[model samples]
Target: MTVRGPNLRLEGSTFGPRKISAWREAVAPFWDVEIRKEDSSEFRGRSDVYHLGNAIIGLTAASELRNERSRSLVARMGVDHVAAQIRLEGHATVEIAGREVPMAPGDISLLDLAQPLSLRSSGYRAMTVIIPRALFPEAGTRLGAAHGTVLRGATPYGMLVNNHLRSLAAHVPHFTPAEARAAGQATAILISGAAGLGVESAAERPLQRAPVFLAIRSHIDAEIASADLSVEQICRRFGVSRSGLYRLFAPLGGVAEYIRRRRLARACRDLVEGGDRAARISEIAYRYGYGSPAGFTTAFRAEFGLSPADVKAGARPDGASAVRRAPTDLPGGGWDDFYEWVLTLDA
Candidate 1:
């Protein structure tokens, strides 16, 4: 069945010191949102603030959002939910199903909201479609399996899914009540097909079996920068035996090593794009669990084939270069469709 509604609108300002906290409290019900501001005040701290809205679709970027409050989401325990995102520009990091999924421009990330999840954007703009557990089709099972998974242009399904989202987002404002319903149905069909559910019912995959690895991975990702973060801590938090944790990483090359690789990857990104007044390599390395510069440098060299310094000196790749586009073309569609879409670009 299709559903239709008028385009939504949301507006909040930082007129007073209390504006940030006011916004945070406002957005808490819709999604877990955070804001980190340079200004330190009673109302707006260095934490997240939420702005309430009835699922919006709009675009934002650059000078328009410099003093902006960062937004973050962590879906607490629940049965299951769906988020269809289309990456219009910039990038996003979403923790799901035990992995850190990155979304770049022109990509799509289908997210399951039932499981605990977190999302962060580095000055990103996109379209997101958030739907209740009941509205989703049977294909949600496979879509769950694909959570925390990054789908880029390399996959046909990924391309098609992204294109469909783009189309839906573009027309969200003009859809008639009847057309809106049809749009929802089409979105579900495409998402189901793109997720490889085929003709088999979504029931083929059970909801009770949400990916346990996601919780494990999410914890690890958050602690990656912490020198004290460890697999043992992960084990304790999830109540999984050490051996179970070891097995989880056996396919990738063991837990400790995996964390190292992931951390180094993050450090590489930071160094290259960190710009002026960026943290030093030593600091980056230490932050990512490296004890010494020598150790961190060795790993960085091996993986990226370039010193962190060299990468920082090099310019951002031409294609990945970020430019502020009109809010209309911002990935994931405009704010009107923001909460309903999942962004999975690879930037």
Candidate 2:
């Protein structure tokens, strides 16, 4: 028997404008996809998504695609997974540290989902595996060091990972559910091992990472509703220097800003989707770590351009209206499940 959850497929050519709309909805959780104007009217692509227990793997082929993910969106979405991709065919450039680094066929790139990412590619096929950052606690340092860097397929470890990914794409779809789950765990463990392995000395500088960075971020998320979530508390709990912690989160607009953005974003979602329970703005503010309702109101308005009341009162699309993608199944696929999976894939 063959199933598509661990082996689903999407052919964008089958739908009209709805195809593009549905694709946007699927990617909205992470990227702000910008299809070239020329390709917008008639977008074409194919996606084979796999569920690897601890990972969501995607093999995508597209025509002239550019995806822009900003720091603001990063804060709003707060999906901190590690996205590792290998270019199979065609050319793509991923912007890192203000530089557009190109990926040729057979190259690997590691990206941090918490940071900003902008990728542009034309007529390309690549496989991307996204896993939660918390999955590999032991190799946080190595993974941190790997962020924003590309590994040439020519390198020893790079070649191994590249081939391993290709094999996974070829065989994972046929595995039974139990087999897939075990594969997912193996994928995480193997990737963690690879993240720890050093590349040949002359190839690239040794990868380095702040040991406590991911753990601290996790702690913040776990404690966002608490007033005790101060920068000092984080430093003491993680046993890291204050300056080091600051530097680690500088890309996300500082530790305090990260927390505030996360709170407001959570508050925004709650107001928009919290149902009857969200009728009171004060309750929403208090639920998200705000001491003063007035302060929460000020910050909320500044970030979302509307009061919590506005969202709750249905000024913006919410609840049923927010399900803009596809209520009924579309031709060649069912995107509703895909959208939900993107939001709920913890590993």
Candidate 3:
């Protein structure tokens, strides 16, 4: 059955025996999932997913699942999202990069979507946060090698993040679009913190540069509305060399491109989903640090392939039109419906 707000809740009973294949197809966008049972029998599962503006949060309960690296699923899927899986019940093991990490209830681990892995879970329940790689540029290398690295959920940071995820999953439906967007940003920050990439004192600094990069990103998000926000300013604030800053943001198409893309994304959300319908295009552009309305319009059209006016006039951008037009009438059931619901959350 459907839940209120922008969510998709599904149960394996809806599709009965087909749940096995449905599960496979549902995750095909992110992984080539397979169900493995001791005996050849039907599989059953359930999941609830919340479409935060920039991240996808899911609470899932399922029977056993198995993925072997020999299957070469990573090559087949070419996934680009990272899954932070937090266990709520049962146990699971993930083998990645020749290391095996097992999770008990309350433990969490990060899985690199692009890497080959073998994961097996018993009858299990979990909360998963799937984040786009572009959002966490600092964590790129760590995440790439984070296959079996487990974060102890009993730790203070892990507990805080776990509770936050639980609360976000429960309250996401009631959040206004702006709140959802804010929550998505908060989610990224929390995940980074949980992974030991938060701002650190000199004595606590790790060898990796992830913490520094995370701090830089947090600052950029905070000052995005300022016209003077620039790489030079970031360098001054972070005490990083221009070359070092450029190297950090290289994967994200360089720092300036990242800032422009983020600002435009927020502008698009404001144009289509903001509560203040009376807000003008120029006002929206100015709010995101665009100095000129013409420049904003040109950049907006180029990035989204639609004029800001078109979006403000209720013309949805490309694939987004379907969700805005019919949020409730998504076709199919089980995993297919879940997959469609997930796609609507894309920015």
lDDT of each: 0.50, 0.70, 0.64
Name the runs in model 3 displaced over 4 angstroms: 1-6, 12-16, 37-42, 67-72, 137-142, 197-347
Per residue, candidate 1 scores C-alpha lDDT tens digits across 213-288 of 5455557667778866887788787887888777654434567766776677567657755778679888887788
- Top candidate, metric lDDT: 2
After superposition, which runs of candidate 1 have C-alpha atoms over 4 Å from their true positions? Answer: 1-6, 12-19, 39-79, 197-347
Winner on lDDT (1 vs 2)? 2
Candidate 3 TM-score, C-alpha based: 0.55
Q: What would the per-residue lDDT of candidate 2 be over residues 131-242, giving only the tens digit for each residue?
A: 7666765644567666666777887777888888898888876776566666666666656766655532111312244556667777888898887888899988887787
Ranking by lDDT: 2, 3, 1
User: What TM-score do all the candidates reach, one by one?
Assistant: 0.45, 0.81, 0.55
lDDT score, candidate 2: 0.70
Q: Is candidate 1 or candidate 2 better by TM-score?
A: 2
lDDT of 2 at 185: 64
User: Residue 273, candidate 2: how far off, in angstroms?
Assistant: 4.4
Better of 1 and 3 by lDDT: 3
In model 2, the Cα lDDT at residue 37 comes to: 69
